[model samples]
Target: MTTFTVNGRTHQPEGPSEMPLLWYLRDLAGLTGTKYGCGLGICGSCTVLVDGQAARACLLHVGELEGRAITTIEGLSADGMHPVQLAWRALNVAQCGYCQTGQIMQAAALLAATPKPTDAEIDAAMSGNLCRCGTYPRIRAAIKLAAEGGEA
Candidate 1:
């Protein structure tokens, strides 16, 4: 059995070792905040924090997650007030809202690594995440706002 932690809770998932982390998270663990888009991993919709770094959940297998810590959007904050989340809310970053969770998770990872990122850095980091709603401007603004610790 592969043992891992999700949102501070431990789990030993029962399934094929090749089962994708996204399926386990959404179907079994009931954490639907992590989205599934472009199963080929081209899109960042399945983004989640693996060992505090952003990773594509759809590309990860349960067997490789033994002893790893995974954090989905639901675990981002108990009060929905993580700086990234607050920034997202304050700036109204979502339009369709389908890609927001992945965007937020990716931004959180970026902020965790680089508290203050330049436009180039932001572009480079966020390049993998696609927003069909074309909210790129607002997304960048919110990331900057979060870095500055500003909300609303």
Candidate 2:
């Protein structure tokens, strides 16, 4: 069994170690908010925080994440009101909305790592997460707003 912390709670993964964390979270754990897109690390749809760092769930095997703290979008805010979430909402960041969860989680991780990220830093950090609907400007604005403690 692999023991880890998810959303501030400890979890024991009983599935195969090679199982991707995305499957464990959605298939076994039922945390569906973490979206599925490219299924590759290329898209950030599966982005989650592994030990407070941005990680791609679709590619991160459960065995690799053992004993680590994983934070999904659900863990970002039980109240649905994290600064990033609020910013996303205020900016109307999603068109398809399928990738927003991962996008926000990635942005949250970025903000956590760098409270005040420059435009280049934000772009550099967010480069991996592809937005099909092209909401890049809004996402950038939201991250900046959230970083400044503003309500989007």
Candidate 3:
């Protein structure tokens, strides 16, 4: 049994250790907010917080996650009001909405590390997350707004 903490709860996920953390999160834990996009780690749809750092869930194996703390989008806030989520809502950042969870999670991590990131820094931090709807401008604005203490 591989023991790990996700969303502040302990879990002994069933299955092979090689199974991607994404599957364990979605299938085993029933946290579907983390998405599966390219599955090659090219798109950031499967991003999550591992020990408060952004990581690609699809690429991380459950075997390697023992004793780690994992936080999916669902864990961000009980009321869907994490600062990034709030900023996302307040700024109307979602388009098709498929990639917004990962985008918001990544933004939350970025703001956690650098509360006052520059535009270039935002681009650098978020360059990996792809949004097919072309919502880059809105995303940048929301990050700035979140940094400025905006909330939902």
Candidate 4:
């Protein structure tokens, strides 16, 4: 059993040590907010926060994360009203909504670290998160709006 903290709660996930954190989070820990777009780490759809830094869950192994704190989209806020979330909503960032959770989670972490990120920073930071709906422009606008202390 590999023990890890998730969404402010402790979880003893049952699986192979090499099991991807994304699978552990979804199948074992029951935290589905961190999605799985691609099994590989190329897509940022399974983005989560490990000690407040955005990481690719699909790339992290459960065994390597024992005792670490993992924060998923569900942990970003209990009410879905976090500043970044609000900004995303205000900017209408979602189209199909399939990738919005990961997008929001990534944005939350970015805002936490760079409260006032520049356009280049936003582009660089969010470049890996692929939105099939092509919501990149709206996502960028939302990040800017959130940094400015209001919804987009």
Candidate 5:
């Protein structure tokens, strides 16, 4: 039994220790906000917060997450008003919307660590999250907006 916390709730998922956190989150935990892109951990689509740090869910096994805290996009805020989320929405950053959740999560983690990141810092932090629709510019703008308290 692996005991961990997701979105403030504790879960002792029953399964193989090698079971990927991604599967448990989407399947057993019924939290589908985390997306699956590259199982090889190349894409940031499965990005989530593990103890307040950005991590790839697809690469993490539940067994290794014992006593860890996880936060998906859904758990980011109670009213969907997280600064990053608000900035994303205000900037209209999503195109297809498939990768937005992961992008948002990654951005949130970055903001948590760097409240006001430089443009280069934003680019470096967001390098892992690929936006197929080429919304990189808007994403950068949104991150900056969020860093400034998401007033937009």
Candidate 6:
């Protein structure tokens, strides 16, 4: 059994070792917040936190994740008030809402590593996450808002 921690809970994946972490998370763990956009690791829609850093769940295999700490969007905050999430709500960042969870996860990781990220830094960090609804401006604004302690 490949045991790993997800959302602060231990999980033993029962599928093949090569199964993507996205499947392990959604199919098995029932955490659907992390999406499957392109499945090619280019869209960043399946982003999640692995050991407090943003990782592409579509490309990471379960076998490669043993012992790592995985955090999905659902695990970001029990009260649904993580600063990034709050900022997302405050700035009205979601359009279709399909990609918001991954966007939030990536933003959370960025804010965690760089609490006050500059505009260029925010752009660089959020470059990979694609939003088909074209919410880039709002997303950047929300990131700055979250950094500035703007709560929902």
Q: lDDT per residue, candidate 5, 7-95, as tens digits?
A: 99999999799999999999999999999998988779999999999999999999999899999988999899999999999989999
Scanning candidate 1 in windows of ten residues, the lowest lDDT window is 84-93
Please, what are the lDDT tens digits per residue for candidate 2 over residues 1-152?
77898999988888689999999999999999998888888989999999999999999988887789999999999999999999898888899898999999999999999999999999999999999999999999999999998884
Root-mean-square deviation (CA) per prediction: 0.6, 0.9, 1.1, 1.1, 0.7, 0.9
- Better-scoring candidate (TM-score), 1 or 5: 1
Candidate 4 C-alpha lDDT tens digits along 1-152: 77889988988866588989999888877788888999888789998999898899999999998789999988888898889889888888889988888888788888899999999999999998999999899999998998898964
For each candidate in turn, the TM-score is 0.99, 0.97, 0.97, 0.95, 0.98, 0.97
Model 2: pairs clashing at backbone N, Cα or C within 3 Å: none
- Residue 3 in model 2: lDDT: 88
TM-score result, candidate 4 = 0.95
For model 4, the stretches where C-alpha displacement exceeds 4 angstroms are none
- Pick the winner on lDDT between candidates 2 and 5: 5
Expressed as tens digits, the lDDT of each residue in 109-130 for candidate 6 is 9999999999999999999999
- Candidate with the greatest lDDT versus the true structure: 1
Per residue, candidate 1 scores C-alpha lDDT tens digits across 124-148 of 9999999998999999999999999
Runs of candidate 1 with Cα error greater than 4 angstroms are none
Candidate numbers, best lDDT first, in rank order: 1, 5, 6, 3, 2, 4
The TM-score of candidate 2 is 0.97
Which of candidates 5 and 6 is the stronger one according to TM-score? Answer: 5
* Candidate achieving the largest TM-score: 1
- The per-model lDDT (C-alpha) reads 0.95, 0.92, 0.93, 0.88, 0.93, 0.93
Q: What is the lDDT of candidate 2?
A: 0.92
Return the clash pairs for model 3, or none. Answer: none
Write down the lDDT that model 1 would get. Answer: 0.95
Query: Model 3 off-target regions past 4 Å?
Result: none
